[model samples]
Target: MIKRKWSILFLLGLSFASVCQAGGDIDALYSRIAQKDIQALNELKALAKDNNAQALAELGFIYEYGVSVSVDIPQAIKYYEQACDLDGDYGCFNAAYFYEYGIGTQKDITQAKTLAKQLREKINLSNINLDKKVSER
Candidate 1:
């Protein structure tokens, strides 16, 4: 059993390494982002998974403020929630703020309050569990 676990870990590690390496001499998708090209931003974002904090945060900002894409507050909140769960400070702030302001989502004082408190007290905040809790209630 232990050997199988090790094998699985090794395979996953190799997969991640290959993904990082296969992107061709390290692409500079950031350049297109800096140039304010929304289509390029979309393509680059597709390359990085939404769960990745950096990607999530960038996506959040882009959607939230219409930087390189259409204004999509809900999409911003979704990405911020993912990023914050991964220890992104900016994500925490953005998610909490958006929740508080009732942007994209119906305003819920309880959720907003809980999120605000979470940001102040938790080092890393992820809203997936919180959303589950709210749904259950």
Candidate 2:
């Protein structure tokens, strides 16, 4: 029993440590992006793409906003959908919004509402702490 408890604690600690490390890089990336350093941003993006939900969501945002890239709504939709599938709230919101607004897909209110509900349910299961934000999205 003590061994099991120790293992759990170790895992929890590691999880916290990983999250903290990720925040530092994310901050640095944001700063680079703010400075409009395209080369650094691309390098940071490659670093991010391997290991995070945020990376995928940021990819979606970049495609959506055309930050240092061409605006391609279909590509934006594809990236957002990828992040949404990975349980990202921002991704879910953007995906549903694009679908709702007919940015890529045809506007269909019923489909939008349905996807919104599905995203909320999935987000609830994956990120229980932010369930309230689901409705806001």
Candidate 3:
């Protein structure tokens, strides 16, 4: 039990360190996106094509808000759908919101409700797992 606890802690610490190291790159990408840099957008698009959920979500936001491309709710929704299919929670949330409000797609309260429930369950499960881990320690 002690060895398992230490192993978990080590893995968590390593993951956290990697996240911290990637923060700078993520910030740079966001900055480029905010500036509407075409090169950065192209790179993101390529990444999205490779099934990068974060890239897809960012592209969805760009299209939704007309940051660089003209505002196209349908396109945004499509990107969000792709991201959600890749298990991106933010994408799922945005897609659900759009469905609920009929922003881009037809109003589908049932679908939205289902998605929201799924998201809730996923979050709950994640929390439960974290709690169990903590308790084990």
Candidate 4:
């Protein structure tokens, strides 16, 4: 029984460590972005492979605004859509804006409205979670 308990605790600790490591990687990626390090682009691409929403959203921004690369509106829209599907609220808003204005996509007010609503809900939920954390502290 003691061995089983120890094994369960070890597995839990391993999972927590992995989660922390992923968070650290994300933080490092943001730090690289702040420095405009070209290596950050590669890191972002790698993270996107795991469907990291922040990485996808950042990639969309980079492509959309021609940050250190040629402007590619279609590519930006694709990344934004992927990020939005992953529940990245900023990406959802960007995708919705593109759909609404027919920028890099066909004008679809209905789709834009749907995405806008989803983004709003996500923001609300995030705020609530933040509030809970603050209160707990």
Candidate 5:
């Protein structure tokens, strides 16, 4: 358990570092997203196609909240899972949330637990405590 925890932390830390390195691009993307820019959305889609973790997470957010498109929970989950697979902490947390509540997919506590565990050791942006949520379930 301890070894797994350390590894998750290590992986998330690496992801966080890369995000920090690209902080300017992320901010610009969010700025465009906030303005409902279709170009930015397209850029995100392009980035997601390359398996960009941050872009995948952003696309998940856009789909989940209907920023410029209709709400598509399943699509959001798909993007979030992709980001999570790349060790994006935010993606892991959000995907875990959906799994925990069965929002887009069937309720799967085990899957939720697995996803949440990936974020438990990281300082994530979501601020939604997946560990607490999973424990309460």
Candidate 6:
């Protein structure tokens, strides 16, 4: 049991480190994009291809607002769904909003509600896990 707990903690630590790394990468990429660094988009795409949840959500935002590319709602929705599937909160929220308002896709209140509920649960679970970890520590 002690070994299992240690393993779980190790995994959690790794996940936290990766999340920090991803956030740092995203910030750097955003800065580069702002400086008109043409390779930034390619790097973001590569990160998305690697199944980085944040990268996928960033792509969704870029496509949704036509930041550097043409506005493509369908593509944005596609990226959002991909990120949502990976448990990205931003992606889930935006996807839910789009579904709720019939922006770019057919209005589906049921799907929106489901997404909202799932997101809430995820947030709750994360909080619970954090509390548990702190107590254990």
* Candidate achieving the largest lDDT: 5
Q: How displaced is residue 8 in candidate 5, in Å?
A: 26
lDDT sort, best first: 5, 6, 4, 3, 2, 1
Q: On residues 24-82, what C-alpha lDDT tens digit does candidate 1 reach at each position?
A: 31245555776786666876577547456666777787788887567999999988887
- In model 4, which residue pairs have backbone atoms overlapping below 3 Å? none
List, residue by residue over 10-83, the lDDT tens digit for candidate 3.
Answer: 99999999767654554567679789788877877887898977778888998999987799999998898788
Name the candidate that leads on TM-score. Answer: 6
Global lDDT of each model?
Answer: 0.69, 0.70, 0.76, 0.80, 0.86, 0.81
Off by over 4 Å in 5: 1-21, 121-135
Candidate 6, 1-137: lDDT as tens digits: 99999999999999999889889999789678666676998999899999998999999998898877789998998999898888888888788788777899998777777666666666665543322222232
Q: What does the lDDT read for residue 32 in candidate 3?
A: 90
Score every model by TM-score.
0.58, 0.70, 0.71, 0.66, 0.73, 0.75
Question: Whole-model lDDT, candidate 5?
Answer: 0.86
Worst 10 residues of 5 by lDDT: 121-130
Model 6, runs deviating above 4 Å:
1-15, 125-137
Give the range of the ten consecutive residues with the poorest summed lDDT in model 2.
128-137
Per-residue lDDT tens digits of candidate 2, residues 8-67?
999999999998897677667766776677875686568546646677677777777876
Q: C-alpha displacement of 126 in model 4, angstroms?
A: 13
**TM-score of candidate 4 relative to the true fold:** 0.66
Cα lDDT tens digits for candidate 5, 6-91: 99999999999977877667668878987989888887788889888888998899899998789999999999999999878889
Clash pairs, model 5 backbone: none
Which of the two, 3 or 5, has more TM-score? 5
